[model samples]
Target: MLAGIRQALPEAVCLVVDDNSPDGTAEMAREFARENGCEQNVWVKVREDERGLGGAIRAAMQVAIDNGFDLFCNLDADLSHDPVDLPRLVETCLSENADVVVGSRYVSGGAIVGWPWRRRVMSGMINGFTRTLLRLPVRDASGSYRCYRVERLAGLDPPRNPSDGYAFIQEVLMRLHREGARCVEVPITFTERRHGTSKLDLPEAVRSGLTVFRLLATR
Candidate 1:
C-alpha cells in the first residue's frame, strides 16, 4: 500500500496512522517508507489505545489541518482502494469544484473484485438503506475512498458525527450530504484485500446498521 502511494504521488506528503498493529505492520511500513525515500514525506503515528479506523482517520485529519494541507485523499491501506487512482480523485475534486469526491463502487464504471455474494449483499444493503433514509445522491455511502477539501467542511467542526469504525464513513457522508456539500462520484474498481483478516463481523454489521438507523431517526 505504501509502495502504491509512493508510486502514485511521489511529491505528496503521506501520513500513516497506525492503531497499535500487533503484527509489526507499523515497523514494516516505516522501513518501506524510508527505503522508498519517503522518510520526510511519509510518517507513521502510532496509537496505544487501538480505538479503531475512525479514530486513526480523525487523528490524521487533525494532522492534515495542522500542517495546512488544502486537500486530503483518504484510502484504505489494505489495498481495497486502488492507490493508482489517487491523482484522478484529487484532480476530480479540483476540476469539478467539489468539496468531496468519492471513489464509488456502485457507479456505472465502478466494480468490485473478488467479493463474495454475501459481502456484496451486505455492502449494497447498507448503502441502499442509507440512500433511502438519508435522501443522499451518492451511490456508495459507506465508501471510505475519498478526497476532501479540508477547508470546505470547516475542518471536522461541522458536526459530531457519531461513529467509531467503518460506520464512521457512513456518518460523515450523511453529514456532508446534509450540509449541502457538493460531491462528485468517480468510478473505481474495488478489490478485496489480499493481506490481513477481514475486519467486518456480525457485531460490526449490527453496529453499523444501528448507527444508520439512529442517524435517520434523529433526522
Candidate 2:
C-alpha cells in the first residue's frame, strides 16, 4: 500500500501511525522510507499505548496539521482500499473545492468485491439505517476512505471532537455538515481485506449503531 501510494503521488508525504504492533509494522515502514529515499517525506510514529483506529487517525491528522499540510487523505492500511483511487478523491476535493471527499461504496458506480452476500447485505442495511436516521446527504456514512482539506478540518477543531471507533467517521461528516463544509462523494470499489483479521465485529457494529443515537440525542 505504501509503495503504491508513493508511486502514485511521489510529492505527497506519508505518515504511518503504528500502534505498537508485535508484527514490527513500524520497523518495516521505516525500512521502506529508507529504501525509497523518502526518509524526509515518510515518517512513522509508533504509539506505545493501544489507541483504537479512530484515535490513530486523529493523531495522524494532528501531525499533518502541525507539519503544515494543506490536505490529507485517510484510508485503511489493510490493502482493502485501492491506492489507485486516492488520486480521484484528492482531485475531487481540489476540483470542486470540497472540504471533504468520501470514497463511497454505496454511491453510483461503486461496488464491493470479494465479500459474501450476507456481509454485503448487512453493510447495505447498516448504511441505510444510518442515512435515514442522520438524514445525511452521503450514501456511505461508515466508510473511512476519505480526503479532507486541513483548513476546513481545523475550523472544526478535530482534536476536541469526542467520537472514537467507527463512529468517528460519521461524527466527522456530521460536524462538517453543520459547519457548512462542502462534501463530495466519489465512487470506488471496496475489496475485502487480504491480510489481518477485521476488527469490526458484532460488538463494534452495536457500538456504531448506538453512536448514531447518541449523536442524534445530543443534537
Candidate 3:
C-alpha cells in the first residue's frame, strides 16, 4: 500500500499511524521510508496507547490540519482499498466541487472481491439498513475509504466526535450531510484483507447498531 501510494502520488506525503502493533508495523514503516528515500515526506505516528480505528483517523486529520493540507484521503492498511483509486477520489472532489468523496462498493461499477456469500450478505444488509435508517443519500455508509476537504472537515471539529470505531464513518457522514456538505461516491472494487484478522465482530456490529440509534436520538 505504501509503495502504491508513493508511486501514484509522488508529491503527496504519506502518514502511517499505528496503534503500537506487536508486529513492529511502525518500525517497518520507518524502515520503508528510509529505504525509499521518502523520509522527508513519509512519517510514522505510533500511538503507545489504544485508540480505535476512528481515533487513529481523527488524529491523522488533526495532523493534516496542523500541517496546512487542503485535502486528505484515508484508506485501510490491510490492502483492502486500492491505492490506485486515490486520484479518482481527489479528482471527483475537485471536478464536482464535493466536500467528501467516498470510494463506494455499492455504487454502479463498484464490486467486492474474495469474500464469501455470507460476508457479502451481511455487509449489504448493514449498509442498506444504515442508509435507510439515517436517510443518507449514499449507498455505502460504512465504507472508510474516502477523501475529505480539510476546510469542511475542520468545521466539524473532528477530534471531538463521539464515535470511536467503525461507527465514526456513519457519524461523520451524517454530520456532514446535516451541514449541507456536498458528497460524491466513486465506484471501486473492495478486496478482502490478505493478512491479519478482520476487526469486525458481533460485538462491534451491535455497538454500531446502537450508535445509529444514539445518533438518531440526538437529532
Candidate 4:
C-alpha cells in the first residue's frame, strides 16, 4: 500500500492512523519511514486513548486541515483501493467542480472482487437500505475510499459526525449532501484485502444498521 502510493502520488503525504493494533502496524509504518528517510511525508499516528473508525478518520482529517492542504484523499491501507486511481479522483474533483469524489463500486465501471455471494448481498442490502432511509444522493454511500475538498470538508467539521463505527461513511455523506457538497462517483475495482481478516461482524453490522436508522430519524 505504501509503495504503491509513493509511486503514484509521490508528493502527497501518506497518513497512516492506527488505533494501536497488536500487530504493530504503527511500528512498521514508522520504521519504514525512518529507514527510507521519508519521515517528512510519511506520517503514522498511533492513538492510545480512543479507538474507532470514525474517530481515527476524524483525527486524520484534522491533521490534514491543520497542515492546510487543499485536497484530501483517503484509501484503505490494506490495498483494497488502487493507488493508481488517485490522480483520476483528484482530476474528476477539479474538473467537475465537485466537493467530494467517491470511489464507487456500484457505478457503471465499478466492481467488487473476491467477496462471496453472501457478503455481496449484505453489502448491497445495507447500501440500499441506507439510501432509502437517509435519501443519500450517491449510490455508494457506504464506501470509505473517497477524496474530499479540504475547504468543504472543514466546513462540515468531521468531529461532529454522529457515528463512531463503520456507519460514519454514510453519515458523513448524508451530512455533506445536506450542506450542498457536490459529490461525484468515480468507478473503481474494489479488491478484498489479502492480509488481515475482516473486522466487521454480525453484531457490528447490526449496530451500524441501527446507526443508519438513528441518523435518518434525526435527519
- For all candidates, what are the clash counts? 0, 0, 0, 0
TM-scores, all models, native as reference: 0.94, 0.95, 0.96, 0.95
Task: Determine the backbone clash count of candidate 2.
Answer: 0
Candidate 3 segments exceeding 4 Å error: 158-161
lDDT of 2 by residue, 1-219 (tens): 899898777889989999998999999999999897889888899987767787788788888888889898999998899999988999999999999999999889998999988778777776888788877779988789999998877777543447668777787788888788888999999999998876666787788889889887766
Task: Give model 3's TM-score versus the native structure.
Answer: 0.96
Clash pairs of candidate 1? none
Error of 1 at 66 (Å): 1.4
For candidate 1, the 10 contiguous residues with the lowest summed lDDT are 153-162
lDDT of 3 at 37: 91
lDDT (tens digit, per residue) of candidate 1 on 71-94: 988998888998999999999999
Tens-digit lDDT string for candidate 4 (79-189): 889999999998999999999999999999999999999889888988899888888888998889899998887898544446778888888888888899999999999
Question: Could you tell me the lDDT of residue 215 within candidate 4?
Answer: 87
Please report, in order, the local distance difference test score of every candidate based on alpha carbons. 0.83, 0.85, 0.88, 0.87
Candidate closer to the true structure by TM-score (higher is better), 1 or 3: 3
Higher TM-score: candidate 3 or 4? 3
